[model samples]
Target: MTSGAITFGVKLPNLSPLASRDSILTTGTVAERLGFTAVWASDHVVFTPTTEHDHPDRRFPVGFDTPAVDPLVALAAVAGATERVELGTSVLVLANRNPVVVAKAWASLDLLAPGRVLAGIGTGWQENEFHALGAGDRFRRRGSATVEFIDILRTCWSDPSDGFTGEFCSFGPIHFAPRPAAGIPILLAGRSDRGLRRVASHGDGFHGTNLNPAAAGEAIARIEKYAAACGRATASRRYTTLCELDLRDRPVGPDEDHGGIHLVGTPEQVAERIRAFDAAGISHLALRVRALSGSTRKEISNRLSVRAGVEQLERFEAEVTPLIA
Candidate 1:
């Protein structure tokens, strides 16, 4: 397929209940049924405190508050829920996970799903979550850790004569069985120089998340620069951007602020906007079904729930999917 013709995926942040896995299971099944190309989850070990005084965009509604299930465990469940959709992470925080164990977990999932694993990774943002895992200072070195981690994962999975040693990881001369039936695509998340450079140098793909269409050019440009610097071309390197949708096209009230950057119009407009990203060099657009920011109270009860989110998904499936497909 042409880069623009490549299928789209979806990212789910905090979709599962901390107490149970059923919510996420249901969501993944629904997304697959809707014909989403892939399903991804976030990696977070703890929740930062949310208070009324904090910005509304920073806070998730109260009932939605819960610890995340380990992504590998969640993906394993998703593997069984759907046959065609790919399974992935929006960005797994490698700093918080043990590399050896993570390699095994992901490899196992790939075996279950075969050629359907997309490995999205990041350095992560929350400091408290690292502390909870006793990986605080080490988390600060996540960029380097991720490079080493991926190298180790590939190393352990292949038939190797010896192990590896690095400041962040080490393993030796042993057989790691059942490598992914097909190679997993490693999509790195971040937009800065170091991040883009790392993606170019090592990653198989790039995850451009929460970027406005206007700002997307700069990120894509950055990727092109780094990829060229590494003697690769943008066309050869895989890339995806995540776009959030709000159903309104223009301001209807005080709550309508900043929804313009979102895919907020009819299905055609959203499709055109997504096509723009593809034209700009994004091979996939990982979308989420939700509105952008507004009043905290309104956001908490009115818009941010699984029920509303699914309705939005149905709307996009009906409208945007056909246009894009």
Candidate 2:
């Protein structure tokens, strides 16, 4: 729980259909070599064609056609190739899968990686996907279900004799073995009131997305206030956010603005933005390297090969990490 210099991580190249397993593996190894503290993967079981709700960011389409690898499995692959970087799930949808199953999967992963797992979890936004996963009944009560999931995970990890009987998830006394070397840190994602409350009440940290420095500061203040109300200590909890980085060398656009959601422009400008977030109490930053301009997602993915990704990582390490570190 001790604070130190800010740490950085990057998302694995598993978001597009063109991203091969080899590229994903290479991305993790390169990130470790470049002195990244962690390498993160995202989750998506299925994408429905239509949704009543819009995407939280409204920048991307809400189609499940994109080829996103399973976060835990992808992280397991990364763990095998890298020795130092932490394996993280940027935001895994918890309510879609059974809590017991998730606990076992993550516990096994922790055993394989041995103290290099960060579970960034969320209730998820796609209700249609929940229905497809046969957890539609639990969708309406996702917040409660997520709380129960955390309880179940902790119980399963804490001791063999422990069990949980929650309103949504209940299990008899069971012996779960190969416990994690240390308890896996759970970071809650999303910016809703319920999300922040869950972070304060049950999570060890917060994993935010699309939030600027000012907004992130406000969110941290609110999280602290909620934590204090819940009698939970907040001084040691981690605050991490995800940002898209435009590493292509180019002049700043007069009209192009990211609304502070991304680290765009020159490396120096991106470094300055990182400093601002660090000053706002953010402890970790997970960056997604932008793909080159292309006609389609597949084309863009093709352009962002492992070689390109490694080059970008090298540049960031040389130009930005030194400035921030």
Candidate 3:
């Protein structure tokens, strides 16, 4: 366990009641004001029955009826609404789309936010959803497709004169312009050995989802091992993870480790979990809180208790942040 300062970011409320234009912008505005390092948005083009079955209840439990905004568009809106805070996609399914178009879209967003873009990308798992997208043929080899897609993005961003010709996409000498001054930081998200190898080979950092301290440490070890084998330095490679922080008192005996990676239980327990994560080498963490979640059918369907959410974030900063090692 290494003692290091862990930067905190908040996942923007971009689904259901929190997904409204106002709520999304409000959450970004508040997170920026609270001194959070970044604001992240999750991606999902179209939800299907497969989505519900694949994801755990805590993720897509609201079913297909839940409103989820497109990740890039949501970040663009947040881009115009706030400054200083980095804009990120927790794990955009890059392999499901044409790389040229996606690259252009990301470049446009980077122009708006300048250097504050963290591209957290992954090969999507929903096979049916992959079929829904036009790139169904490439689903089987999405790992390689994703790798080539990053190549395309970097190629176009750096120099588009030659363009790219990869297994999944072939483009002419496209005139791509308005590049991000700071360049997009590519963070790879995966839980497999192949994923860890990609982290060592391609990613500027690892985007860990639902990873606890022990698991996070093991993953980092694998990544370092791979990096050493390839003569790559892992020093600049950041360790970041996303998890839910159910920072409320309850009778459930602290289901912190039961669900994915979560910071549950009292404020003290939450603080301890964060310290453990920090000790495990997580340098940054983006969290989702329950206080800011959706209301029941009796209340407004398209609204979030933003005030409660803000209070919860404030409480974390005041109470938990100070307690971490």
Top-TM-score structure, candidate number: 2
Question: Residues 172-278, candidate 3, lDDT per residue (tens digit)?
Answer: 88788877777788999988999999989888899998788999999999998998888786457988998776566642363334643777776788888888888
Q: After superposition, how far is residue 69 of candidate 2 from its true place, in Å?
A: 1.2
User: Tens-digit lDDT track for model 2 on 1-325?
Assistant: 1114678898886765445788788878888887889988888888776752445443441234777788899899999887888988988999878998899999999988998999999888788889999999998999889988888888888874856778877777798887787899999996988889899999899999878898898889889999999999644688999887766576466454356667777787787788888889899988877651111122223344556667777888887776665
Sort order, TM-score high to low: 2, 3, 1
TM-score of each: 0.84, 0.91, 0.90
Q: Which 10 successive residues of model 3 have the least lDDT summed?
A: 294-303
lDDT of 2: 0.79
User: Which segments of model 3 are wrong by more than 4 Å?
Assistant: 1-4, 53-61, 250-260, 293-304
Backbone clash tally for model 2?
1
**Residue 178 in candidate 2 has what lDDT?**
74
Q: Model 1: per-residue lDDT, tens digit, 71-159?
A: 77878887887898888887888877788788888888988999989889998876667777877878778888888888887776775
